[model samples]
Target chain A: EAGVTQFPSHSVIEKGQTVTLRCDPISGHDNLYWYRRVMGKEIKFLLHFVKESKQDESGMPNNRFLAERTGGTYSTLKVQPAELEDSGVYFCASSQDPREKTSYNEQFFGPGTRLTVL
Target chain B: AQSVSQHNHHVILSEAASLELGCNYSYGGTVNLFWYVQYPGQHLQLLLKYFSGDPLVKGIKGFEAEFIKSKFSFNLRKPSVQWSDTAEYFCAVSWDYGGATNKLIFGTGTLLAVQP
Candidate 1:
């Protein structure tokens, strides 16, 4: 089975520009998540999707960032009017159904899209 | 706020040397710990995970981690490491928030360099 895959392995855009990063989760996986690493810092969670509905999005930093999983199989994170601080690597991950909070479920990650905002 | 810390920013070891990387997390209540490795030009991959049961867990590529609840630590270890083991190691912890997602808090990551 193929693991999670991300589009536009690397992206460069000017400040105030818009960029959309896509993530395709593994087949049959119902849980999708987005995370990012800024500079050399640790990876931080952004949001999560279970099927077509968003399970949690509290991690979202601000209103300028938006994430959607239309059909529940793929997800897109769009950043409007990107800032200089938006330069970093965005990673997408997926796992089996996450109905049970405490249940152990392995999450596979993608190669990550490196976004550079100048 | 909860957090994860990886003490070693970088470590250098000769091939066949014993290895141990310290990972500490601060979070009350139940948590699931994980160790992930990212090789050069590669995506992050799961090295091992600890949800419950035996605190000691073994993973692929001869890597292992022991979860010590008292210490609030889950340190990665290997009896012997090879040159192929050089990579960036990250430690993460996810809390059981009784919510839809387990928000994973990750460490700054440690770079391991193994000499041939």
Candidate 2:
């Protein structure tokens, strides 16, 4: 099975510009999550999606950040009016059903997208 | 709010040397622990996890961690370090919030350098 994959491994954009990061999770996985690591800071959760419906978005920093999982397949995180602090690596992950007793259901991560805002 | 702390920001060791990294969390309920590693130019990957049962858990690549509930600690250890093991390690915790939603709280990473 293919691991989680992300597009545009690196992105550079000016402040106030809008940037979209894409994540394609493993096939048949029902859980998708987004996290980010800022400079000199810990990786923090952004949001989670379960089959096209957002399960939790409480970690989103502000109104300028938006995430979408339209068809329960892939996810997209969009940052509008990006600030300098938005520069960091964004990681996406997916896992099988947590309720499945047989499978450990560990999350598989993708090669993060490094965003640089100048 | 749940939080995690990794006491070491960086560690350097020679090959074949023993390794230990300290991790602690502040949560007053049942929790799951995890350790993730990210090598240079690579994505973060799971090194080990602790859900229940034995407090001592072993993972791939000869790594292990001991969970001490009383001290709220889950420390990673390895008997011998290898140059290829140089990477950034993050410790995280997931709380059982009594629902299907499971979120993780991560600590600032520790960069490990194994000298050859």
Candidate 3:
């Protein structure tokens, strides 16, 4: 089975521009997640999707950032009026199930999309 | 808030050198730990994970980590490293996020540069 895949390996945009990053998870996976790592910072969770519903979005920075998973197939993270601080590598990950008795399911990650907000 | 910390930012070593990277986490209650490696232009891969039972856990490529409950740490170690081991190592902590789910928090990462 193919691993998770991301689109537009790299993206460049102005501070006020809008950018959308996409992720396609492995077949039959039921859970999807988004994370971002800024320069000199650790990777932080942004949000999670269980099928088409939002499971947890407390990590979302602010109103400018939005994420959605349509039909529980693919996910898109859109940053409207992107800011300089938004420049970082956006990663997407997926797991077969999130209900493991021990919560020890292995998460497979994508190569990530590098966004440069000028 | 829960978080993970990696003591080393960057480490350089020659092939066949012993390796040990420190990882500390601050979180109440039981926590699951993991070490992830990212090679150049590659995605993150799990080196090892510790959920329960035996504190000493072994992973692929001869990597192992020992979970010290008292210190709240899970450090990765390898007796001998190769040039191919050069990568960015990230320490992560996973805890219950309610509803039978877990969320992972990653560290800043330690870059290992192995010289052949």
Residue B36 lDDT in candidate 3: 96
Question: What is the overall TM-score of model 3 with all chains considered together?
Answer: 0.97
Instruction: Evaluate model 3 with DockQ and give the value.
Output: 0.72
lDDT score, residue B76, model 3? 97
- CA lDDT, every model vs. true structure: 0.92, 0.92, 0.92
Q: TM-scores for all candidates?
A: 0.97, 0.97, 0.97
lDDT of 1 at B41: 96
For candidate 1, the per-residue lDDT at B36 reads: 97
Give DockQ per model, in order: 0.77, 0.71, 0.72
Q: Where does model 2 sit among the CAPRI classes?
A: medium
For chain B alone, what TM-score does every candidate structure achieve against the true structure? Answer: 0.97, 0.97, 0.95
Candidate 3 Cα misplacement greater than 4 A, ranges: none
- For candidate 1, give the lDDT: 0.92
**Location of the lowest summed lDDT over 10 successive residues in candidate 3 chain A:** A96-105
lDDT, candidate 2, B17-111, per-residue tens: 99999999996688888999999988789999988889999998999999999999999999999999999999999887666666789999999
What pairs collide in candidate 3?
A: none
